[model samples]
Target: MFTNNFNNFILNTDSYKTSHWLQYPPNTEYVSSYIEARGGNNSFENVLFFGLQAYIKEYLSKPITQSDIDEAKTIFSAHGVPFNEAGWQRLIDKHQGYLPLRIQAVPEGMVIPTGQVLCQVVNTDPEFFWLTSYIETSLLRAIWYPSTVASLSYYCKQLIKAGLEKSADNLDSLPFKLHDFGARGVSSYESSALGGLAHLVNFLGTDTLSAIVAGNRWYGMSEEMSAFSIPAAEHSTMTAWGREYEADAYANMLSQFGEAGKTFAVVSDSYDLWKAIDNIWGGELKEQVKNTGGTLVIRPDSGDPIKVVREALQRLAAKFGTTLNTKGYKILPSYIRLIQGDGINPTSIQKILDAVTSAGFSTENITFGMGGGLLQQINRDTLGWAMKTSSARVDGYWRDVYKDPITSVSKRSKRGRLALVHHQGSYMTVREDELAEQNNILQDVFLNGELLIDDDLTTIRERTKH
Candidate 1:
């Protein structure tokens, strides 16, 4: 379906991009561009390399067919745009429809600092120098958002880990700390799938089904263990029982899923959060909850998350009693816990944890489910992502090329061929020519329409383990 779409094959780039003359300097035969996260959101150092392998497999695995060229020619001609007919024909005749470009990238899932090159691209054939930038326009667009989402998720993990270190006995549950509930909140299925998989790079809990499919299909992960979610109730199911029978509704959920230590979540804020928790849940259904050998995860969907989560923890602790963990923090009874799914993001998550610990509760007493903030509410600027030409070969000489917009100093681009190097316990961006071959961390991830690096989900997940 993607290959047949004429727009998908072409860059669908800026209107000026249609003219080859506008893309390169006179006599330019080859151009090189590097991609980076240029510092934004005060979390630049938290950005991690992810989603490149999946992007390559999904978008660049197949070569451009003859039909693709024909479609491009038709569209350009219809719009009276300057079409590179000779260049297109040459690619068809010599390269057999495959893109003649070399893409080198840091290994997927590596934690790299900001302003360092994440990936570099250059056309192998001099005639296709314009193709390099043109292709990057799409590739960068496809990658930056998911990469940002992954970085945001990783940053959340670091914050949660810190809180857990102080408030929990063990950090083993860190992987399930943040759950992806952003599937419906995102714009499309593709967005949900990509963003959800990105979140999985750092943590394992997810309610996004498409992400699981994406992991299995694109990253060679098994559906059984790639991502997981527990049986849970939503507003419709709980509200259907009516406000008068709210207690019965809670009883039904526990009765159905409460078997042999099974775990489930019930949305408790559909009618009255406090009344339902006190009268219905802690009052009427207390015996049923205690008898069932299962864990009941109470979800407070609406309100100030920090206040609600801490209050829910306190009430649960008071009703069921609490046990002190080895870390000297109070843990909720084995059969009860809290989930705050409202207003969750990296910053808000940290705030909630701070409140939880300050209120004498362990971080393990609650888990988080993020929606728009996790998947849909970010953009390229979230991490200051950009791809710009750093060099070009003209008249048998490789000359550095960069744009230093005087108005915006931060928009300045790098110069010369680039390589990411690990030095002094951190990754640094340096000119490729200056570095010895061994120090370069960038690997050949793609070449001539073939994916050179295929990373698995487990490998990527392990990279964020620390």
Candidate 2:
């Protein structure tokens, strides 16, 4: 759940981090760090800034209690790592246990290009200089994972958008085109919640319910159905009915959830996919499917995605008939559609789209439910995400900090206090001391143990439109 820390900031970081208090420069009072996604792939240049507020609300909002310090001391003492008991005690006594940090960032869900700073942090109290970097382990993890997932989802949207524009009449169904089936595919419930919410930034349909809980608890979306899904059947539900009753199992699905305006999904590849689509769905249940007045999503769980989808669409159209849009692309009946939930990623999706297009069908005839490919296939280095110290103050003097490795110019970090601003129409990372005319887009999000900005999903969703 990622909340097993007992709300303890004292034990949240790496064990080696316990000794950092003794390692800092003498009279070190201030330390500054910034998080960025250095652009590697030209295609993934723009990224959605996300999940900092979740970390802030979940971890940083709570203070380190004396018991936390006591527990941390015991853990570190035996573990041979130095614990800052005095510093933690001072936090409880003087600051009421809140973190002395000033966090600034571009608004959540804004898709800014890479090589720009998305978030920056500095210790508010000089005494807690080590605190800024100490929070890096948690802070960077929060941003990188969700942000990377959101970016992958965003690029998927662009792919679907382009496909729809070329092969469909309108983009009316764009949001629900790519549905999330990644809840069980992730490593943890918290990862599912965080990654699921990330996918929601671009699309509206999902099977991941935990995303809605996170959206409400952290980003303040509607408590009810932050992401929507329809009644869907898995392999177990179909197989439990046995192979002989496969037709009956599908018929029961239609009887149960197939009302007017209510959509439902059923995995159709149980025994024989062609037999299920041809004999069962199109032949036997043809009249019922036409009369249900709701959309029936047929899922193909195995076989070559391109061949399965193209053949399934042709088979469905052979029985049910197809309507042509103004653009003249083949459109399936509103009551019927095809979904490919296996091995779905952008490359496979594009290949399947190419096959669909070649077969004279519109993209409207298809929906995609991506599981692990949508959520777990990415990592921190997927977009070159890093949080690095850019500035530090020692004995009343400030100096820019950075690393310039001769081996890799791309690994070089930024120097000086940073500000994210829009200069000449695009986002840019610049030095705060050197900038004068341009307005900094990075706003104070959290400061001195208090949240400075509270943004809901509605506001964040609107930002993605432009």
Candidate 3:
């Protein structure tokens, strides 16, 4: 079953509504018929989404086959959008066999750099030229959020590296463990899951249920840690409802699920964190954890994390009778780890890591949890992934017209389509928009009616790993 979080966004079989400046004319059969002719399966869901029903009405056909309906319905259901029986029939009638020119983008988790054409679409039929005008907005809607968040995760990895370098001394070892905990801040469940998957390229743990379901469905990773649920407040189960109880609960929880050679993180700022640690892990619980050989992760959710980490380490050393090397060097894997979560951004990470280095505790014992700085704070447009129309010509003149809000370029589009090629060792994004009349290395991805790019996410991820 699909998780409740992503169900609404993916299954939204509503009209392809957009927030762009361009719109197509009503019943413009030329475009609709063109899509229908070239293996385009149009449905009301697509039509409404495209928002071109009035323009494409002239090319409207009878109801599409159950197979087509089922395929779309399945896509929607998996995404968690409730089926809209009320408008299903109407959409089927309007978009049957009308495949809108769809661009098969690189899978969700692939880390694409700035200024790349994440995806693009055009009319399948020559007469349907007008349909291409509407693809930019929705395509970006699909591409931007995940790419941006993934990119943020990538940068965060750099901070982790920096922290490691600064604290090489006095630390045992540190694992690059990053977790996405920004679901509540995301605009929709779909975005949350996509963001989570994208982030996995750099950070593999997440706290969004939708991300777990969607990531496994698309990326073949169901067993991955997608969510971590432990409330900060104590409950009534003999564990009293306060900070002391919370700390004990954390140590006990880790002790209960003892996984040797693995790390289990506990939020330590539920009340007075040092007090909790002294009260719970200090006397007996700490020894139990040490004996079990499982590493404990103390998360600082409030206050100056760097200071907290220093004090926590000091207290641990005093209690355990093991002194921390104040200079540089690894402390060893058996020591506990520290994770910082509150208000962590790229800039803040540098600050905290620098502070921790000055105080002691090698960088190997620290990790970070990033949430808002990525999902809610960054603007997708700033990354600059756009699909522009470049022209190809029967004549020798080649032109590339790129649109910018501030200015228009003189390079006119050559007209036709675009395809990317692998030449030498680098990728050569070419314009099928016009054929060169010479043999080119790139293959036509969507030719006549079939899509040629391999749709598997794993294959793409592996191929681009260099």
How close is every model to the real structure, measured as TM-score? 0.96, 0.97, 0.65
**Please, what are the lDDT tens digits per residue for candidate 3 over residues 125-201?**
43334444443444444545565565666666656766665656422232244667787887877667666666655
Identify the leading candidate in terms of lDDT: 2
lDDT of 2 at 173: 90
Clashing pairs in 1: none
Q: Is candidate 1 or candidate 3 better by lDDT?
A: 1
What's the C-alpha lDDT at position 238 in model 2?
97
- In angstroms, give how far residue 185 of model 2 lies from its true place: 1.1
Q: How many Å off is the CA of 144 in candidate 2?
A: 0.7
The CA lDDT at 183 in model 3 is 79
Candidate 3 or 2, higher lDDT: 2
lDDT string, candidate 1, 19-88, tens digits: 8556566788889999999988575575787888887887777767676767777777777888786787
In model 2, the runs with Cα more than 4 Å from the true position are 1-5, 40-42, 222-224
| Residues 351-426, model 2: lDDT tens digits | 9889999999999999998999989988888899999999999999999889999999999999999998876777
